[model samples]
Target: MKAISYSRYGGPEVLEYGDLREPKVGPDSVLVKVRAAAVNPVDWKAREGYLDPVLDAVFPVVPGWDVAGVVVGLGASVTEYAVGDEVIGYVREDFLSRGTFAEYVGAPVRTLARKPRNLTWEEAAGLPLTGLTAYQVLVKALRVQRGETVLVHAAAGGVGSIAVQLARHLGARVIGTANERNHDYVRSLGGEPVTYGEGLAERVRGLAPEGVDAAFDTIGGDTLKVSAQLLVPEGRLVSIADGDVVSYGGRYSFVRPDADDLTRLAELAEQGVVSVHVFETFPLERAADAYRRNEEGGTRGKIVVTVAWDTAGPDA
Candidate 1:
């Protein structure tokens, strides 16, 4: 099977595209024929060796976690899905290797969910990681309730955009921070747009004068500090980007795979309560380009890598 992999940790330059043995389906896993994969900042960060301390990386590592594909084979214990089932998964295993950036991935049942029928394959691929992140932080960590006010940092980016929609879906009034150019986009996601940077806290205060009930930070740094000040004394705060949030009495959230949670996200997508925006897409062989685009940052939505199994061209 064809896949993109790297034998050593480095930048996108180290990625090599070629043939590799197909992944093995274990008793708790299913082999999926990849249709599309989404690029997350973590993909590039892992390539640069940032996650080495936490995730062991075997040589010739395939670097993707979000995939929308069809199940081609299933493990003996995998009763939740069968061959020919279209699914989406945040296929992060205990170790780094045999990832979704390939023609096939052996995904554990815990990581798989039926793909939202309402979404395009690229959109479905984009949802798992970002949707799970937003859901975990807001619904689970912050416990945002209806009629409350919530502030989301980087509101127009991949995860933030979903956070904005999810917060609104939960009946919370959402205030999102983005660049001047993305303010309108944030508003379209049902968030009251506030320009980020220097006076972010003040801007949020102006929008929710009584003080926000919670805050979700996708961009770390002083943004966490700003969130701390913008919230009410006991307001919850969660950050996906910074661990130092603990010092501010806030929780640092790391997204994990859960079939139940992924299913709920799919339900939300099917109900039109949330949607994924695909800012751009590249063929599977051009995955390095997808990483470069994600690294440049400030994309309004997700970047996807489409797979074409029937052809030998770049699109294939």
Candidate 2:
């Protein structure tokens, strides 16, 4: 299968686009013919060895997690899907290997969900990881409630964009941080926009004088500190970017692959309660460029990589 892979951890220069061996279907996995894949920050992070301590790399790692594709084959024990079914998955394994950047990925059933009919294949590819991260942190970690004021950092970015919509659905008033340029975009997601950086806590206070009832921090470091300071007494806080949130009486979260949760997100997408904004897309052969784009940051929604076997050209 043609794919993007790296034999050693480094920069974007290490991502090689070429042919690799096909994956085998396991008893608990299904083989998906990749139609599109989302380039997440974690993809580049893994490529650079940032996740080295947690996930051992089986060199020649194919890096990607979020995928929207068709099921081409199924494992012996899998009955949830079959050939020809369009699906989306956060196809993460315990290690760095067998990822969705390839033409085919053997995804465990736990990571798969039906693609939302309302979303294009590229848009659907962006949903799983970012959607699940936002949903889990809002529903489980923060437990945001109706009528509560919530502060979400980096609100116009992938996870934050979804967080704003989902938080609004839960009845929480959302205050999202973005540059002045994206304030309108944040408001469109049902969040009150607040320019991030200096005086962030004060700006949030201007919106809710008593401080927020919950805070979702996607940009850690200084932003996490600002969020901690903007919370009302006993207000909940969760951060995915930094584990130091524990020191601020907040929980640090990592998104998990839960079919049930992914399904709920799909339902929300279908119902028009939440939608993925596809900021840009690149062909599979240009995956390195996709990684560089994501690494540059400030992305409004998602940067997706598409696989069209019939149309793919030689790698640049």
TM-score of each: 0.97, 0.97
Off by over 4 Å in 2: 309-316
Q: How many backbone clashes can be found in candidate 2? A: 0
Q: Per-residue CA lDDT of candidate 2, range 1-316, in tens?
A: 8999999999999999999988989999998889999999988888899999999999889999999999888899998998889999998989998899989889999999999998999999999999999999999888889999999889999999999999999999999999999999999999999997788888888889999999898889999888888888889989999999999999999999999999999999999999999999999999999988988988899999999854332231
Question: Distance from true position, residue 35, model 2, in Å?
Answer: 0.4
Per-residue error at 106 for model 2, in Å?
0.6
> Clashes in candidate 1: how many?
0
Against the true structure, candidate 1 has what lDDT?
Answer: 0.92
Among residues 3 or more apart in sequence or in different chains, the pairs in candidate 1 whose N, CA or C atoms overlap within 3 Å are: none
* Model 1 bad stretches (over 4 Å): 311-316
Candidate 1 to truth, TM: 0.97
